[model samples]
Target chain A: MTQRSIQMDEKIISRVDLLNICQDVIEKGNTLLTPGVADYSVVKDVSNLNLDASALPSKISYKSYVFPRTEPVLYYKRSKNDVQLIDVNIDSKKIVILGAKPCDANSLNIMKHLFNWDYSDEFFNMRAKNFIVIGLMCSHFDEYCFCTSVGSSPVSEKGSDIFLIPLDENNYAMKIITDKGKEFITPYSGYLKSGDENRSKRITENVKQPDVAFDSSEVYKWLGENFESPKWEGVGNLCLSCAQCAFVCPVCHCFDITDEDYSYTEGRRMKNWDGCQFGNFTLHASGHNPRDIQSKRYRQRVNHKFRYYVNKFGEILCTGCGRCSRGCPVSVDIKEIVSNCKNDQKELR
Target chain B: MKELIKHARELLENGEVAAVIGYRQVSAKRTKPVIITDPEETSALVFNEYCLNNLAVYLTKARIKLLCKKNDKVLKLAITAKPCDVHSIVALIQENQIDRDTIHIISFNCHGVAKDFGFDFNGDNLASKCITCETHKPLYYDALFGEVKETPQASDTALARIKEIESMPHNERFEFFKSEFDKCIKCYACRAVCPLCYCQRCITDKTIPCWIETSSHQRGNFAWNVIRAFHLSGRCTGCGECDRACPADIPLSLINRKMSMEAKNLFSFVSGRSLETPTLVGSYNEKDNNELFM
Candidate 1:
């Protein structure tokens, strides 16, 4: 690798300055009608304002720009013999999502294959491509976070256009990673400073320890070998089957497709997230259910990420953000499962 | 043991079953789902914990291919399922996802399978989900094997955890829980495993008006989780199927357990254990929980 000289400048931009820059960019995208999900905060942003600040003490922040809880495809009316496809309007524009964590952004690229390979989905693709993610370095790791186990880190930047390394309280050493990132920073290059040793040290010292510990490649082996191990019933028993973990996961990408028509024949096809926890995720229209039990379904979830996806994609389909555990009403931690699947603990008769 | 293979062979050879969908040892490390036909292949058929996939999901794709021609004779299939797997069969039947008589179900009483650890079953313990399963026996099957073993009724840590959270100051708990849930990545592993959660269309993926943000924000993640719980409200059996399938390992069961408990309290109904009666959420009564509308 050609050694890019390590350098840092002395000027520091406030969070307000960065956010203002983001706002102006969002404004431009909005006015331009950029096609995709924008990362800039929008109108009616009253509820979660200063959202990044709320996640204080944490190294990175979560963006407020979620796709949606659920959105209606379109309203329609049907007619006889003729199928009238209602105009499905998508208003999302391409945007630069600021301060997104590295782990959250990388999974989008990993998920691209499942949603778009066999089928061309303008839905997620449009929003995905439109958004240029700018990830910030993390200074901390949570117990539940296992980003490293899945091949990500506080410095991981596989999915970011531009990555910001914190050099000092007032300044950031911005590393332009992509041409898009260069385009993104051309206007604000004035805010960045020249590389310095102190700045580099700040970036280095601020980098947090890896959150998760495990070899994902080995997890596939562990899961494959331990299929009939009693671990399934143990972990499966703890499951409430609400599918919350799947909801919060970054890499679990199984969708069910359906066609909807208003009246008689006027609607577009729809695809939605389907959870393996649901018995229906594997049920056939022929009254056969393959994954009825929690143990079996849970086994598939683990195997799909560690074994099946690796068999197919040569990578585990998980990001290890710990969102599933945090958001899960029951708190079933995947990291613990990985650790316990080969736990040194012995069973008492 | 050859007799068991013989029965599978008979089903295949006599045309009673065009396919005997069972599991075979893929390697010393794992047993995967197999579509066996002809007696020669029957040697591969065996029941083991490594045969963990529900096998129900394949039926949709399999039936489509088997009964491809309009009203063409569908292949007679022989399948095996444990107790929990049987619930999906029941749910599929209730939802009309499949016809009951179209295929044969060779059931197992479910002796509490262990995870086929690296295809080696003896050392690896059973999956955690099976430990607390009250549905330790299958409700329906054409033929069955294994002895019915009683599963111990364990205390539910999920309900207990929910109670602890509920006991906290409402906003404090909400904020605490919300912060935790904010890390969601929107992967649908939980939905993929749920048996009763079968919806040809889900409301979460729509984009025209953007009901919920698809972005992986904390607010968006929390809303998705709440919506998920609401969608499964009364319909969820206390089976905890979604929780187990979660790769993110979210504690999804707390939501289902709460809803299941609520359904029992309000409608006096318990999910599973009975196919003769529909769930309280399946059908509505006049004096139902009208508090929401009120």
Candidate 2:
């Protein structure tokens, strides 16, 4: 595989012009998604777009736009002697995600390796191909955020097509990073004005990032060596075995397929999101569950993110958006858990 | 707070309890649940207004329950609970989900709790469950602590909103809930947080018959939420854990509160109040009202 070189073409757009560009995108009948107070929603009115650089990441990531929570793979119609199969019509609509946090922007790129690993999933590939991520520089940090430890930062533009740096309240300096971004911005070139790259670089440099909580490689090493540690039991006792963490995660992409019957003779095979925390996620037909205990399941969750996925794909499975810890019912902080993986005390801080 | 640590440490050191489930301060205004088995770790336990989680929920977890067994002998598990959380423990005992003799409760005269972790303990930040709370002191406890402070008063906006939803026309009300349920991602955090939802295999997860679709589409979400509320109709203790656990902010307790009202009005029964009285749904009487059946 060939590596794409970084393109450093810089441009500037006023806030008003950016909104106008968004409005134009909506006028073209393309889907426009922007961060709302809690989640990303369709942006029919550009005025409601929340581009606050200091706001925390949305409760749910925009992964569903590319990999829907539930979608049909194929439809089957059964007859007396034979069956007829109907292929699903994949939606190829161009989706423009504006104001995505840097942590969220890189999720699709991380997930792309998994979806295209053994067999190419056309469903995920089609939608991922049509995505245009407009990442905005983030200036927010909470106790739960650990993006810096996982090789990303508030100002990192690892996966965005067009990255935006807020120069001021009224202006933004945009850096086109990919050919797709350049192509997308060419028709709206009237809104673009050349800007100084040094100014934007200085602003990006000054953006405060969350302190690295733990070394990812140390966590990876600890996870490999301490698979049977009692720390798993402590976390498992508190973890209620819910999939909220996986569902709201930016890069946790495990799915299950089931067939649903719409009628006596016709039905569709659907693929839905699944999580490692669920007790039944690893249940077998023989009435035996290998990961029956929550401790083992919880161990799988941590090892998969920090160890196994890294070993297999050379990429960590988490973006450290902190949505899991922020929204946890039991207040189980993954950042705290991963940081204490090597500690003997394993105290809850 | 010092007294709480002393009591918990004594329980653990003397082998009176296998573990103590309590809250520990994580930040200035946030506390997270901590399960301590060692006597030395008891000092981490703290009780404050930020202890919003209902620790009773842990009593029903299979993994947590295993902590009660040591050297083939069953030991009691201690829990530090708010006054309202005791109701859930009462409900669990009444339903025969847990043995009363195998557990110990350390409760406080809670004034109220903050609405969430970071919020200040003020009128505006008072939890919805605390607004209508009638019990500031635990009805039952092995050991009690804390001075009985006056609970702050907050306007019952949740009840007012429930009334508003009730006043809507049939179609409008259905549409209102349909939209709210549509936001559900089927994460089941609500179920995971509720102490009463202790079923080994949830109805939604029963794929043999596929009673409820697992997909989070409109019809599936509607079936799951409505069924969940119906199952908890007479049994729910109104802890509002489900509401807080929902990531989509769907206001799920509205339906549970409405069902609780029906349970009170129809049967003159409030769940989890006493162990002497049999459960409303678990027991039946010949003279029970038949109007709903008609």
Candidate 3:
């Protein structure tokens, strides 16, 4: 495999031209997903797409567009003597995501290493390969946000194919970062004009970032040193074992496979989203569970994100988007827990 | 607030309780649940309109319950709860989930709470459950705190919406709920937050038979939501936690509220109101109406 060089091409397009391009993309039979008030949805009417630079990240990331919550791997049929297997067809339609937050844009890149490590997953690869990420510069953050702590920032263009910075009300400065972005934008060259890089750079520099909450390496070190610390018990007691954090996360990729019977002789094998927070996630057929208690389960969640995944894939699993804390029923903040990981035992007590 | 901290401290310092489950201020307008076993940490305890979580849910968690055992001796676990939250505690006792003697309730005269973390406790922002609340003071408490204060007024739109849904034809009602349940991602945050959903093994998690499909697709989501509502029928205390916790903004409590009304109309029973009365789903009566069955 060869690494592609980052492109330095810059272009500017008015808001209307961007919408026109989006409409064209839709007309070409490609799926166009955009950030809505709540979550990302498919855009049928391009006028409904409002790319507010300061809007908070959508409640759920667009990772599902690549890795669906539930998808069939293969179908099976039974007969009197022999069994037959039916293959599933992966949807190969190109998906163009517009106005994605940088925090969300980097998720699939972090997850790509895992899916390709032990075994190459064609189901994931097919969708991911067909994606064109158009990331937007984020100028907004809240108490729950900590993107800077995890090696991502509001304006960092780590995983975007084409990055956009809003210059004013009607115009955007776009930077084509990859060959795929250039290839996708070439046909729309009639709508794009030469842009002033300095103006966009100033705007990018002005975007406020959430302060670093904790160093990832320090937290990783603390986790490795204190496997049985009482701090786990404290947070474990507070966590309700809901797994909302994992579900809303941009990069928490754990899944389960099950076979569902539609009839007596036919069924499908489904790959669905699963979380480590559930008590039964680690249960065995012998009725023994290694992570039996909520504390141990929670410990796995933290360790996996900061330490274990980093050790295995050389990438931290969390993008620090804060969806978990914002939607937590019991208000268990992952930012707070990881920040406190390096503190002395007395402060936690 | 001072009285609450003082009482919690005294309880912990005197070794009367093993832990105090309460709320701690996280921001100007938000409070998060905090479990403190140390006497000095009780100062962090607070009670205000911003404290939205029903702490009774923590009482049923096995990890939280383990905090009550120290040095081979079992001690009471103390809790700070709102008056509405006490209803959940009462329901848990009625279901025999926890013994009344093993817990200490530190309840307050709540004047309603905000709809969410970053909202003001005003007419427009008042939580739906607080609009029709009749319990300003806890019915059962080991220690009481806070002076009574009047709650802000809000429209009962939730019940009105339920009535509107009921008036719809069966097909339209099904479509409305089908669309709502379609947005479900199957995170089960609703189940985790409900105090009454304290099963060691949930029905969905049982894979040997796989009664409910764990997928988030249309059929799977429908089975899971309907089954969850059926299981929680006549038992939910209307905390509104599930609605708030839902990332997809599903009006989950509306179905539970509608079922609670059914329980009220059919049997003239309200859950968690009286300790002596048995739970409607748990207990059987010979005079029970079998009209639906027939």
Candidate 4:
């Protein structure tokens, strides 16, 4: 399990050259995933992979590859007196995700903690284990971005197997971080070139560090005590109580299970993405909902990310990718909300 | 704009209302719904091209209950409504969701709002609903603002897109919708943003019998989306919030507008026009089409 680092020249393979890698993977009966349409679409297979990194962080994250929006878990059939169960087998295959941002790569670690916490999710674990992350250091940041505040930098390679720092229009300095990464890149050994000292220096100085919006430590403390803060109503009032935030978020992994029938003779059980913002998330069979209002539901979301997950797993749930704010119809910025929570008494209004 | 703010301030300052649901400028190009309880906060309210959200969404029993928890007495709300939003208010009042006397309607005359203020509102760029909108001045209002602009006639351009879909081969249309619905993440933003989607429990959430499959997969997404549109068939006010809120950018307005067209042709009915008549689906008539049933 030895790891090796190499420098690849832009002349060997350009930015669009990643499509060649996609082709290589596809030819080998593996999967290739790429950012599509500069937004939520993900094009699968080598022929379809758009190698544009201009859309660094896609509108939706790469979480869907590991935890699909919907997956068949099992199947069942009923007879006169006995019930038969059938297990749904998930095929494990090598998967390569290209153009994933550093923050999105880091999200895998955050999501992994919860999926394997009390009970292991073999479906997620199997896919996660087989998939390889090819992370690109982000060169762009919008007003909603605050990755620096959440302990992840633009180029932090916490979860990526292979990390790429864009050096120029057509080049990237690829750094192999793990034994898995070394093994993954062995097929492309021909492209490996001797490291240049000057280009390495440029890669470091070239990337712009995103400014830290607020201290998470302050937010964690404030959330621990202010469970019934009036600001929840003020902040949550505009929220549509929609799952846009959760579905787009890289680390939101909550899911619900249900069974669908083909007929009275057979049915298949499925696992689907669920959001705590939904009114039915905590509904009791006795016609009671503990969190009846949008304010309460919104409060749960903030607390779960900053306080509950921190307390339970000793890690933050958010990667600060800012997709939630960017895609929100009402423009509910999580950075602004967290900053206001930190400086509670000194109201921003 | 100043007059609207002053009116909202007076409602709050005089304790005439518990909260004023209006638009506040967030960025130069975006205005969002804001519930202002304090008179000073009324100054933040603005009505402009960017004010696109139907504030009538806040007029619900659950939402009103949340706003009134601070005081024991019945809470009064004053909401700024454009012509399209006033239609939703009328529908809600007719359905008995809100007592007419408990809330104040601050209506306004509007030509149309830009879908995105960042872009110009040319004929090609205007919101689809606005392209066919007939309401420039509200039919009902306690107080009104701005001059009545010319009410644009229903444009063939709006129906042209729907007609294009209709003109497509049946299989092609199915393929087109399947591809669009495939991208749906099941965020339910369409349901959450609609004022008329005020069900205490949505059918999708019911799991005892598991009505609609809650998955975002092809089959489940098709079922969920078709069911939602069917439920809102004659009742939808064509506000287009559902289409605007969709992160997947599914053309939800197409299905809604198609249903609106069916209602118009079949029953000669338009939703939210007046509170006197019941919803098309809610009431039955001797001339109602029973030929299909036979």
Clashes of each: 117, 0, 0, 0
**Candidate number that wins on TM-score, 1 or 4:** 4
Query: Could you give candidate 1's per-residue lDDT for residues B204-286 as a string of tens digits?
Result: 65545557655444655887888988887766654454654453446777767777677778777766556787755568788
What DockQ would you assign to candidate 1?
Answer: 0.05
True contacts kept of each: 0.07, 0.78, 0.85, 0.62
lDDT of 3 at B253: 88
Cα-based TM-score, every candidate: 0.52, 0.98, 0.97, 0.91
Fnat of candidate 3 is 0.85
The CAPRI class of candidate 1 is incorrect
Best by lDDT: 2
Residue-level error in angstroms, candidate 1, position B181: 16
Docking class of 3: high
DockQ per candidate, 2 decimals:
0.05, 0.83, 0.83, 0.61
DockQ-based ranking, best first? 2, 3, 4, 1
lDDT of 1 by residue, A139-251 (tens): 55655677888888767767777666665555565666666666667788665555554765566566666645777766777777888776576455445455666655666
Chain A accuracy of model 2 expressed as TM-score = 0.97
Q: Is candidate 1 or candidate 4 better by lDDT?
A: 4
**iRMS values for every prediction:** 11.5, 0.8, 0.9, 1.7
**Cα lDDT of model 3 by residue, A1-349, tens digit:** 1115465768899999999999999999999999875579999999888699899888788889999999999999999998899999999999999999999988889989888998999988888888999999999899999999999999988888889999999999999987878888999999999999999999988888899999899999999998988778777778888778888888988999999999999999999999899888889999899998878888898899999999998889999899888888887888988998885754332
* Model 1 regions lying over 4 Å from their true place: A1-12, A29-78, A343-349, B1-294
lDDT of 3 at A332: 82
- The 0-to-1 C-alpha lDDT of every candidate, in the order given, reads 0.60, 0.90, 0.90, 0.80
Rate residue B55 of model 2 by lDDT.
85
What digit string (tens of lDDT, one per residue) describes model 4 on residues A1-349?
A: 1223444332224555656666778788887777654243444545665545456467677788889999999999999898899998996987888767878887777888888888998998888888888877777787777898999977787778887776667766777776677778888877655555477557767677778988898899998878877768776677878898999899998898888889998998989999988888887888799998778898899889988999999988899889888777677788888888854353322
Error of 3 at A40 (Å): 1.3
